[model samples]
Target: MKPLLLLDVDGVLNPMSRPTPDFHRYRCTVGAEVYTVHLNPRHGRRLIDLALATGSELVWATTWEEHANEWIAPRIGLPSLPVIPMRPGEPSEHGEMFKTRHVADYVGGRPFVWFDDQVWAEDEEYLRVHQGLADFLLIHVDPGRGLTSRHLGMAHEWLTLTGFSQGS
Candidate 1:
C-alpha cells in the first residue's frame, strides 16, 4: 500500500507569521469567515515531487477540511486531494489533538507522514498505542516558520529509510 502524505493548512502551509518574499498573502473566505493565508507556491511543486518520488498520496488533514481543496490547493498549485474529516471545536477523548484519533482511523494501518503545528508528544504516544496502525512520522511544523525544505527532506528520508519509497 502506498504511504500517505498528510498535510495541514494553518501552520503547515498557511504559516502564522510575517510574510516573507517566498510567501504570497491571500484572503480566503470559508463560510462567513475571512482568513488571511500566506502560501508559498513552490511548496506545491515540492510536495508533488515528494509524493511522486516516494509513491505516496497527498491528503488534507486540516480543520479546513474540504475548504483546503477549494481555497488553499489551487492557490499553491496543488490538485484537489482527499480530506480527512475533522470535527472542529470537538475536544479529543485522549487529551491529544482532536485530529489524532481521526487520523489513526483514516490511515487504517497505512504508513503516513503528517505535517501539523499542533501535534505534540501526546499525539505521538496516542498513535503509537493505536492498534493496527502502520509506521508514521508526525512532523511538528513551527507555526512561525511554516513548512520548510528541511521538513520535506526529513519526510523524504524517513519514507525512504522505512521502505515506503517507490524503489522499495
Candidate 2:
C-alpha cells in the first residue's frame, strides 16, 4: 500500500499569517454557523502534484473536517478526499498538538507524512516512541510562508528513499 499524506489546511494551504488578494476568501456554512477560510490555489496544485509524484494517498487531516471538501477543495482544485475525523471536544495533554492524537489513531501503523504548521518536537517524539510498524515524517510548514518548493523537494526525496513507487 502507498503511504498517507496527512494535510492540514489553515497554515499549510491557506497561510493564515499573510493576508493578500491572491488568496481566495469564502464563507461556508457547515451546520448552524458560517465559517470563512482563506485558501491559496497554488498550494493545492502543488500538493496534488506531489501526491501523484510520490504515489501516496492524499487525505485531509485538518480541523475543517468534511468542510474542507465542501469549501476548500473546489477553490484549490482538489477532489473529495478521505478526512481524518476529529472527535468533538477532544482533550489533549501538555506538549501535544490538538490533532496529534487523532492523527496517530487514524494512521494506524501506516506510513505517513504529515504537513502542518503546528508540529512540535513533542509531537515527533511521541510518534517516534509509540509508532512501531511504519515510518513517519512530520513536516512543519511555516504559517507565514505556507508550503514552498523546498518542502515539496524534501517530501519527494523522502518518498523516493522509502521505495513507494513502480519506478522513478
Candidate 3:
C-alpha cells in the first residue's frame, strides 16, 4: 500500500504571513466569517511532484475537510484527494492538537507523513506511545514561510531512509 501524506491547508500551502499571494487569492463567507486563502501555483506543482515522486496518497486532514477538494484543491491545481473525516470535536490536552487523536484511525497502520503547523511535541509523544505505527513523519511547518523545498527535501530523505518504496 502507498504511504499516506496528510496535508493541512492554512499553514502548509496557504502561508498566513504571506501578505501578497503569488497565485490566485480566494475569499468566501462561512456563516458570520469571511475567509481568504493565498495560494502559490508553484506549491501546487511542488506538492503534486512530491506525491508523484514518493507515491504517497494525499489526504486532506484540515478543518476545511471536503471543502478542501471543492475550493482549495482547484485553486492550488490538485485533483480531488480523499478527505480524512472529521471526528466530532474533542477537547485537547495542553500541547495536543485536536487532530492528533484521529490520525491513527485514518492511517490504519500505514506509514504516513503529516504536514501541519499545529503539530506539537505532545502529539508526537502520544503517537509514539499509543499509535503503533511502523513508520511516520510528523513534519511541523512554519506558517510564516509555508512549505519550502527544504521541507520537500527532508521528506524525500525520510522516505529513503525508512525504506518506503513507491507503490504507484
Best by lDDT: 1
Candidates' C-alpha lDDT: 0.92, 0.82, 0.81
Worst 10 residues of 3 by lDDT: 16-25
User: What value does the lDDT take at residue 135 in candidate 2?
Assistant: 87
> What is candidate 3's local distance difference test score?
0.81
The clash numbers for all candidates, in the given order, read 0, 0, 0
lDDT of 2 at 45: 88
Residue-wise C-alpha lDDT for candidate 1, range 1-168, written one tens digit per residue: 999999999988988879589999899888999999999999999999999989999999998899999999999999999999987677776779989988998999899999999999999999999999999999999998899999999999999998988734
Clashes, model 2: 0
* Alpha carbon deviation, residue 43, candidate 2 (Å): 2.4
Ranking by TM-score: 1, 3, 2
Stronger candidate by TM-score (1 vs 2):
1
Clashing pairs in 1: none
The digit string of per-residue lDDT tens for model 3 on 94-154 reads: 5678788788678887888899999988988877776467588999999987877888888
Winner of 1 and 3 under lDDT? 1
Off by over 4 Å in 1: none
Give the clash total for candidate 1.
0
TM-score of 2: 0.88
